[model samples]
Target: MEHDVPSLPEEIIVKILLRLPTKSLLKFRCVSKSWLFLISSYDFAKAHLKNSNDDRLMFGSKGFSMDLYTWSPQSAADHSAFGGTIYPPLDQNLLVQRVCIDCPLYEPHDVVWFEGSCNGLICLSSSDESLSLWNPTIGKAKKLPNSGTVLDFDYYGIGYGFGYDELIDDYKMVESLSFEPFAGAPTLDIQLKVYSLRANSWKTLLNWPGGHAFGGSGKFLNGAIYWSVHRLDGPIEWVIVSHDLSTYTFSVVHLPHLHNEDNDDVNVDVKVLRGCLEICCERNTHMDIW
Candidate 1:
């Protein structure tokens, strides 16, 4: 008696394997060298990543530890309502059930919450000053090349998104870094450099119009990175500087001023409340929405 060999078409196997989460796929790669190569291929990873994005767009928040949550509009009565506090808390069991079963790349640390999310990716920087571009769904990550100098005066910014560009076929990451003297007083000699992920290199851009300082975290949205730019002298006005993710250009957007009583000791600040951007007035009685 003779036995028949069990076999399936390559396309069928690929279709089935794509359904597995990234972690399981990584382990299964050890089954064979061919499987490892197939799983690690850029094209295969990109396809799987696109499929994962289609699955769901999960957002996490930064706290003592990252809190991962999936937005389920279907669970609510009115999906069109923006401010309805209808989202359910995603418990550990549910996280295991959903993300673990389908997303093999769902490591606890990989779900990092940045100051903001943009274009299906999050901007992350390490305390050691290392930067990376990460897509959590498919576990695809690219470490950005560091700025050569650790000058105490250096400042860094990152932006990522898709934009209409006649020259490029895919989206890109635009990073900007500026350097100024720490002790010589703020001057016009500050230098700025911009990096393009597509080109995998950096180029010097025009200097900022005036002496400006950035503190806290940066937010990426609508093909630009927005951050608080502090002016040296003004009515305590905070400026929002936006760097075009595609063109690598910088522009300023005005922030709404807080209504305040004439008190010299009063202080105001800007912050993101829930998901909306808001300004906290000095009196602490009202929040002005811009």
Candidate 2:
């Protein structure tokens, strides 16, 4: 006689599933049609990300073509057999799992740019200025249509910010473009536009100051994406630029005072730590945090 496994309640099943890593959850989605539906649901995706124990650091490159690396902290902490991994905690080491994904490019010479990550979805921007939303876990990707701001890449340059808006249960893509001065124009113009996943449309927003956005990727915190930007005009100084996801407006945050005013060229970066924004400034000999 065959013994049957006990049926699990839906609530209990959800609790168990929320704790699983994305890699495993993707596989479990094939168990049944019901499971596939549940795992693919938006509510489940948010819950799983909120309750997940597997924190990972992802690294990608435009030069590396379709390849990426993710380092899992939970797996490192769980493995105690490796004595050499004891120095700075296994979570600190780069024990990476390499991943490769197929991305549709707008241009042959277009390079890949990992724009940002919110919950489990990643925003990808190509050199040709196309955008895509990707979920590495489920292996699902959606390409966003051109916002129609600049047709032939004639704009000076384009930058992006990605985050989620909880009030409306939506994810947003904030596109910032700095335009080169027209022949008669006095100063450079910066245009702003927002793409809403729910609306599946792009809406033009108010213009922001024209300046170069601190590169790499912006950090998303408290429903906004923050950028360390260098102002184009006035005295050379650094300012924090933030776009609120809910209000769809931009605001500037002040950085901590620097004792060495003469050394304004200090390297600065923003990071989220302990549920708050931390501005890190690196001096010649030491680093300061605020």
lDDT of the candidates, in the order given:
0.52, 0.72
Model 1 vs. true fold: TM: 0.55
Residue 117 displacement (Å), model 2? 1.2
Clashing pairs in 1: 21-104, 22-104, 23-104
Residue pairs of candidate 2 with colliding backbone atoms: none
**Ten residues in sequence with the least summed lDDT for candidate 1:** 92-101
Assess every candidate by TM-score.
0.55, 0.76
- lDDT per residue for candidate 1 within 244-270, as digits (tens), equals 656667787666654456543323334
Residue-level lDDT tens digits of model 2 in 158-267: 66788899899999998877665565443456677889999999999864643454532467889997777665555446678887889877788766555485664566
Q: Name the 10 consecutive residues with the lowest summed lDDT in model 2.
A: 81-90
